[model samples]
Target: MTKLTGRLDDDRRTLVLTRQFDVPAEQLWTDFTDPDRLERWFGAWTGDPASGQVMLTMNAEAESVPAVPCRILHCDRPRRLSVTVTDSFGTWQLAIGFDEDEGSTRLTLRHEEVDLQTVPEVGPGWEWYLDRLTAAVAGEAPPTLEDFVDTYAPMGQDYAVMISGS
Candidate 1:
């Protein structure tokens, strides 16, 4: 299970999730920034990142999926990455931070300026994705979507109550 926290930043709501791995920061950074490595877990991206934009395909769902346009907002190599992703659903302001301590790396993912109404779906979605990354890094099979729906779906109520401050 993952622990997600909600807070306000600059009057905007933010949801954060963190995971710790017994891996070096450099390796974790590569897993995030390297296109090939990213494909193993999340999705593949085309176009040069230096150009500030890329078309990302979420290949985990369908073999032939439309690519989404992602604009890089802030990038600090091996440390932080911030981007705005526009897809069919909506625009997502996402950021990931990597911190290494005592030979372990802690990955923090922040979904910023999010609508409180979407917390139920958005929170578990990230938990599933991060678990996928964890599996990829461990060289294990990724969790099936069915597994996520069965296990993490109910946690949405918890997230709702949390963000609602009730």
Candidate 2:
């Protein structure tokens, strides 16, 4: 499997994560927008994610985190999705772009309007989630949250330093 890394853009106040998947854009789109497929890697959402507001329960084990309310900003199938998510912390703007190549897809996830201080925490979490997505696409078991945290925690510091230096 290919390793994925996220780039923190201080000027734009966005955390950009890019990954190349061996699957087609349609498959990648389903993995991202379908509730059943999303639950495999990210979270399960209720309500209409395609048009209106939805409540997302992070992890199938709802006890892990409270449900977050998110408003769908834009939903262009197999191409782009933008949403504003509100949780205990605050509201966040997220946009995902998918570009299809010959037999693969390039996915770029941008977390816009991010706080510089939280990059350390947020960046690694996204990395772990993306890795889980990769595993899901490959029909492999996703890593547990604890395992992901333990393995990627150190990379958070590296993200912090990179963000601080830039």
Q: Output the number of the TM-score-best candidate.
A: 2
Residue 20 in model 2: lDDT = 91
* Candidates' C-alpha lDDT: 0.84, 0.84
Runs of candidate 1 exceeding 4 Å displacement: 1-12, 62-64
In angstroms, the error of model 1 at 72 is 1.0
TM-score for each model: 0.90, 0.91
The residue pairs that clash in candidate 2, if any, are: none
Q: Which ten-residue region of model 1 has the weakest summed lDDT?
A: 3-12
Candidate 2 structure quality by residue, lDDT tens digits, 1-166: 2233878665759999988998899999899878999999999889875468999888833268888898999989889999999998899899999999997999999999898888888888788888888889999998776766577656787788878775
| Model 2: lDDT to the true structure | 0.84
lDDT (C-alpha) at residue 69 in model 1: 96
Alpha-carbon shift of residue 79 in model 2 (angstroms): 0.4
Among the numbered candidates, top lDDT falls to 1
Q: In model 1, what is the error at residue 88, expressed in angstroms?
A: 1.5
User: To one decimal, what is the Cα RMSD in angstroms of model 2 from the true structure?
Assistant: 2.4
